[model samples]
Target: MTARETPESIVVVLGTRPEIIKFAPVIRECLARDVPFTLVHTGQHYSRELDRVFFEQLDLPAPDVHLDVGSDSHGRQTAAMLEGIEDVLVDVEPDVVLVQGDTNSTLAGALAAAKLNVDVGHVEAGLRSFDREMPEETNRVVVDHVAEYLFTPTEETRLYLEREGVAGQVVVTGNTVVDAVYQYADVAAEKSTVLDDLELSPGEFCLLTAHRAENVDHPDRFRSLLAGVAQFADLTGHEVVYPIHPRAQSRLDEFGVDVPDEIRVIDPLDFLDFLRLESTAALAFTDSGGVQEECCILGTPCVTLRYTTERPETVYVGANCLAGLDPADVVAAGSLMLGKQPDWTIPFGDGRAAERILDALTEVETDTDTAAATVTPTETTATETLQ
Candidate 1:
């Protein structure tokens, strides 16, 4: 195959902390290899506390394009992102678009790029919850089908794609989330003053976070979950440090649910503060997908609040237990797992995910005629049937 000039540009998109953390290594790798690339900020997360702080503290390259498509109804948020992202794709004309994980922004970026016939590469691909009720599950499935390169984080994920007959090379490149945690945890632990500020000793507090779209959308479930956590804290006499998500905060306000005094509702934290909190906590209760991997890697036990998890490797190994949305179950699971010895191990690979992703992207067999050739026969068949 003839080697064309190096790609004019590749676009890396981020709108959340997990995306930033997971994409950090990939971005740095692109720079180290002198690959031409640009960063795009989708503003799905608009707060300085939630979004900008991460980019600043991590010393991530400032995003070349910022689409401040802030908070809105789910459909409105996604639709706004689609229009904004498509415009960026047109202006930049990137050869490939890289999106991470199952977020609204991820799906928007992928759809925008794929619609334009630009090569789309999805990092952290093949994660499945098998529950269509989850918007994230649908987002993951759709993006996988459309992505040109699927950089899966585990062997399970790779198999998941193959079982669905997804075309493209599926590479189990380990998880970049592990890569971020491993690379930053040590420095963060030493540098972060989060424990001191919170006025708590390490291992004395339980870290809790609940910000999934599914959980927050339902008022009854969300209220019960919060009340149960508060009860657990009151009963155990252990402080609960919850770095609140913006969406969750709005929901609490709308529902007029008072955040119990025992459960501390703090502003969203940057990566370092978050890691310091995660590493030092007695245990974590969360609805987040990334924290499951981070807690397991840190040897911290976790009780997931959702009914199902895409990161089942952590659950299968026993690091995490799914407590669903029931308040009683949350309290019981939280109490049981807090002081227990963590037996679960991460089946996600050992921190080389970024390198593997880079390798896969660079090594993909680029058949220029593949899209056209597949379309011609389908079109011919349609015409013949009509005649």
Candidate 2:
């Protein structure tokens, strides 16, 4: 092990709603440990609903650096974020940067840090949809290859890292989503009046959240998914409550795809409100990977609108099923899931992922002091050549 150099200083980078929810635990852990960390917001999700609401709802501290780099083409967005993040890394000079999931923001953070010869700790690493077409898959693959420490949610994902021969210390730190759910479920239950506000009763509604680029970018596919969801809602006798994502809503408007009357479209909810609904809903239908994990943990059966999912544990455990965008298939999958009980063993983790992630980070010796587990600082990550 290399001798410890300096006290750990971390830059936590985030841009979207899920990143905020998922990263809250690690931030809270940093507070508890008195680890000096800076929060950097790339502003990838520009809307207040999609970004700021999460920080406020989660009671997370505001970002120390705000890049304000909004949406664009994937190439443009990623390049902008990379440049902005590089500036922050230069200014902060953090020992490591922490990025979560497979968003462009995640990739940018890892890339910026690796370019500067900084260690990167990736949360929820090694997630693979195995579909090259999905931008997320590319982001995940790239970030995993560059990151020094890969904190995966499950042993299955750890094996994925090993199989890929990724040059990183892969640790199976149960997902921080589980930690967030366990920590906030009770709080959400007590504080959230979302059901009452929406005039919804438990088991009376199905939650729908479809914001994947492939699903919403095309008018035909988006409309078909909604039609299928509408059918699923009718079949299950549960009204679909869709807290529409901005991207999906924009496509609906631009493409002039009329949403079915059976599906009630509403504004996006804060994490607490959404979590409350997710916990109480009879069923959930969505294309979101994070929602699948959340519903699985909250005991809500989910019907995935997409064909492929990185988090196949939900399907393996009977908590979720892929219904695709076909109207009939969506209805069938929803019906099948509705018949089953939400008793699948929590496949993500034991609700201590934040602690575990930090523990692994702490184990990473900085400058030549022997730690049982130490992440060797990469002068140039293997992914750099690919970049």
Candidate 3:
């Protein structure tokens, strides 16, 4: 009934590669501290490159449970995840369910845990694009309201929660992505040969990724984006390398959208390989929230392909610009961003978020246990005196 009631166990649920990357530090901290926790994979991103390869590359333990809920319509995917996650919650009966980021898995994990009367901990919580048209915004809002612990990534986000009157206990733990980037940047540089393999020189090739449902599901927008990439390449004379998402590839075939010769289309890369490419890129053009944050930390200028973004810090700091879905606009934004200096400060954490999160969870449990122990004798004494 109170924040002091400690959870006996924790279940960490994730579905996509970004979630895996962001949560990897938390998972590692749990293992290192000998915390009682289990990893559950909802299989939101099912491809080997997108999913399993990250575990191998990151040296993370394989998930104890995999829901295998692959791609589908938003409603159907959420429903499948809810059903599968509900089953796991019932069996495990964890005192707390931990979910990161705004995804279907985050929403489902929170909803199921709340329904089961289990405590919910939402990492990277209180993010808002203020556009209900985007499913991620809706997921974030819902999860924040239900979570017992809101581990927000920034002070701005904590204020967002306060303004919303969120009942959850909010803590500004900073974004764990910062931790992931600091931990892996050097590893990627030492281990990855992506630049050599792709025959790319540092800061000479533009890296691109666009696979948001809003962009790929609409034919005109998708075509316009492709045309814009072509125009950008033509204007800058820099090769545009796109590691296509499976969804985008399907849409390309379905809509008969042609990729330009200057744009090299390739399969997705593992986390290390992609980080190596991203860190060395001339500029990144993407519709991914994760990429926007990655570029900001890596000091690379970025052109966001979406109309709006939840991560406004990157834009405010002048490390990123929103280019929407127009070809001419995308080219212009890319050209403008290329000339800007990468002299922005990192707005995220100090790369110690995981340790802080583990400390917070441990403190909560200890306080809860101490409170329970103190209350039992008081109630017992009162009862004995009355008798």
Worst 10 residues of 1 by lDDT: 378-387
Pick by TM-score: 1 or 3, better one: 3
lDDT of each: 0.81, 0.85, 0.85
What are the per-residue Cα lDDT tens digits for candidate 1 across 46-114?
874556678776767888888888888779999999998999999999999999999999999999999
User: Each model's TM-score?
Assistant: 0.90, 0.92, 0.92
Q: Give one digit per residue, the lDDT tens place, for model 3 in 265-332.
A: 99989999999998889899999999998888887899999899999878987889999988989999
Q: In angstroms, give how far residue 47 of model 2 lies from its true place.
A: 1.3
Global lDDT for candidate 3?
A: 0.85
Clashing pairs in 1: none
Ranked candidates (TM-score, high to low): 2, 3, 1
lDDT of 2 by residue, 167-204 (tens): 98877777889888878888898999999999999988
**Per-model root-mean-square deviation over C-alphas:** 10.5, 7.6, 10.6
- Off-target runs (Cα >4 Å) in candidate 1 are 1-6, 48-50, 363-387
